[model samples]
Target: MIKIVSFVMLIVVMLQGFTLESDYNRAHQKAMQSDKIFIIFLTEKECVACNKELMKIMNAKNVSSLIEKNAIFVVVYKEQKNTFPIEMLYTTQYPTLFFLDKNELFSCKALRGNIQPKELMNCLKLR
Candidate 1:
């Protein structure tokens, strides 16, 4: 029983470790290679609204699939200044979205609030 419990615990820890790091630099590189870009900024560790918005977007299926097919998704934690991969795209808002092209062309604003997944998909699919 002890061995079995230990093995199960090990598996759980390993699985947890595989979660996405959301590193701006790595995500940006992936985005630059892709056809579209989806970048989001959350204020900091203490913002509940920001956390909820991030959770909603990250777990959103339509958003995730669209991102997988057409865009690269990035999450920026605002309190951490130097971690942002690109300095030119800074914002004062807690939750702001920057839609871009493969060449880093800033396109649209998909800010956090009450946006729905279908609406987001439709917006992204548009030219």
Candidate 2:
């Protein structure tokens, strides 16, 4: 009985993690409707650094909570370039992070390359 209860609790906790939308248009729409910022994460499937950075972001509790409360998070892979914006094409780095304000404009400088959880929190506070 305890094991079953623990499993259920685990599932619930896992479900509380940040949700990454794949479609930029849909995510932007939702963000505008909610009056929240839009956060775009550009990554590549075969990039080890990107995967590691993503894992750090997801595992950071504070970062997850801040993102959930104030932003619409979206992940666009290299294979899904069609979903990305032309403005973002200038970036060739993996695991790039962009924060768009409520007006759908960039809130701050784009973060490229490897980023730690604390660095991510600092970036969020910038906007």
Candidate 3:
């Protein structure tokens, strides 16, 4: 009975930590280190262009590959979303890509519209 109880408890704890929201925060913290870059996705729910841009980024193999390796990817939903800081830091742009080096400085304007995977990959490399 004790063994089963412990196993169940472990499973519960692990499951709680598996969410994307939690993972995003953890990765964001790590990106503060010099070795990592942060690629933040600011999105609005009602924007058609934003949705299209997000789809492109999601399917972008090269961008995804680079992001998986050396960058922290954060998806922030704006326009009265629950995330206060994201709403404060960003605005109505449905899809915005904010790049930051390890120093967390604002590197460029929010990249909107459809983005090519290779272009995003090249941007990160330049960072």
Model 2: lDDT of residue 26: 88
Going through the candidates in order, what is the number of backbone clashes in each?
0, 0, 0
Q: lDDT order of candidates, best first? A: 2, 3, 1
Model 1: lDDT of residue 40? 46
88 Cα displacement, candidate 3 (Å): 6.7
Best by TM-score: 2
TM-score of 3: 0.63
Q: What is the lDDT of residue 109 in candidate 3?
A: 48
Better of 1 and 2 by TM-score: 2
Tens-digit per-residue lDDT, 6-121, candidate 1: 35534543343312325666766776655456454444556666656655655676666665666665555665565553633455556666666665566665555555667667
lDDT by residue for model 3 over 5-120, one digit each (tens)?
A: 33553454334332122234555677775377777767665566765665556555565566667676665566433432443364544466777666566654456656666667
State every prediction's TM-score relative to the real structure: 0.64, 0.80, 0.63
Which should have the higher TM-score, number 1 or number 3? 1
Writing each residue's lDDT as its tens digit, candidate 2 over 8-91 gives 434543576666776888899899898888889887766768866766677778998888888888877767746556778777
Q: Report every candidate's CA lDDT.
A: 0.56, 0.76, 0.58
Better of 1 and 2 by lDDT: 2
